[model samples]
Target: MLNIVLFGPPGAGKGTQSQKLIDTYSLIHLSTGDLLRSEIAAGTELGLRAKTLMDQGILVPDEVVIGMIDTKLKENRNAAGFIFDGFPRTVKQAESLDSLLDQNNTAISGMIALEVNEEELTKRLLLRGQTSGRPDDQNEELVRKRVQEYNTKTAPVAGYYANQGKYHAINGIGEIEEIFTEICEIIDSYATQLNA
Candidate 1:
């Protein structure tokens, strides 16, 4: 199994790269944002709870998010591997994820951190906002806030993985295919290591 954690700041192309990885490797892509949105759309109990917190601009409780992820992991147990995106946002969540994967007798084979300049990220986000009609991207203040929040909360998770010697930093700025190539190389190298 080739479990991976895809880490990057907002507008770092994590989503785009994740799609490519999934296609190339037949890996399950587990995006917490997508999962929460699906839950909210379904109006399930967990969705309702997350909706209340999200509507208020507050962070959803960790347990709720973790529980949702736990369910997804079980559902995808038969997959060759998984790419976790937009998850393990905090150190606490990272520890929790480690425990959860350990219980399933799997471990993160590697973590790919996409590195992009803040200016480039902001420009990309603004363009995305214009094209996608995303309210958060449309507002400069909100975009800045999101970037800051990601730095404050999500960036540390990279360190957590780094300490485990599973972190690979990849340049995120470039054509989509180029970035995907970088990520693919890292994953392929890890696969070779596992096989050896």
Candidate 2:
């Protein structure tokens, strides 16, 4: 399996790159946010709980998020691999994911971190807000808070992966295609190593 973790800040285009990777490699895209939304939309028990917290503008507890992810992973067991986006945001979660994958006899192949300047992120986020209509994006204060939260809570996970020698930093400032190319190179390198 070619399991990958796509890690980056909010406006770093992790989603875009993940999509490209999925298309090129046929990896299952396992986005926590998307999974939660799907569960909520399906009105599952976990989704209901997550919806309550989300409705109140609070983050869902790690256990609930992990439960949702566990379900998705099972469903995609036959996939070529998985592209994890917006997950393992904490050290505990990262450890938990490792245990889960270990139990399944699989492991993370690599973590791709898209590196972008904070100023560029802010600018891109503001522009995205104009069209996205997401409340978090529309509110500057909320946007800043989200960025801070990412830096404080999620950024450390990069270091954790780096320590494992599975972290690759991709420069995120450039045309979309250029950035995708850079990411592709990293993925190709890992794929080669894995096949070898």
Candidate 3:
């Protein structure tokens, strides 16, 4: 399976680009945020716990996320590939992801990380909050905190992937299409090698 990790901070256009990648590559989108939201909507036990942590901008426990991913992997065993978004935020989680994929006889082909400046991310998120009604985006303080948290806690995950030569950072400041084109180019390069 052509498993890919779409790595980026909040408001870095990961969600937006994921749709295009999904359409172009026919990859199943595995967004932890979406999964948690579904559970939250259903009022599942995991959702309730995740909600509390998310409300405080804290990442949900790794075990909970790993379990969730286990289910997703089993559910999508026949998929061509999977685009992992909003996951593996920490090095430990990345290690866990590696083992999980190994168990399924697949590995992350690449990790595409969007490199967006803090200023732009803040602007994009606050603007989105106006219409998205997302509590996290609606508050500038919370948004910055989330970004800071990513820098402190999540940025190292990039290094983990880089160590394995599976990390590609793309500029996230250009027009959406332009940024996506850059991402596609990187993914295409990786896909070609995998296929060969």
lDDT (Cα, tens digit) per residue for candidate 1, span 1-196: 8999999887899999999899999999888878887888899988898777654445677888788878878998888899999888898999999999999888889999989888888899999999985566777776777778888888888889889899899888889988888888999998998789
Candidate 1, residue 153: the lDDT equals 84
- Report the error of model 1 at residue 60, Å: 2.4
lDDT of 3 at 113: 95
Maximum-lDDT candidate? 3
Which residue runs of candidate 2 sit more than 4 Å off their true CA positions?
43-45, 55-58
All candidates: TM-score = 0.92, 0.91, 0.98
Candidate 2: count of backbone clashes, pairs at least 3 residues apart or interchain: 0
Clashes of each: 0, 0, 0
Residue lDDT tens for model 2, 1-196 = 8899999888899888889889999999988878888888899988898888765546678887777778777888888889999888888899999988887779899999888877888888888999976555677666676777888888999989999999998888889898888888888888898889
Query: Residue 139 of candidate 3: its Cα lDDT?
Result: 91
For candidate 3, give the lDDT of residue 152: 96
Alpha carbon deviation, residue 25, candidate 2 (Å):
0.3
How high a TM-score does candidate 1 get?
Answer: 0.92
In lDDT terms, how accurate is model 3? 0.93
Off by over 4 Å in 1: 52-58
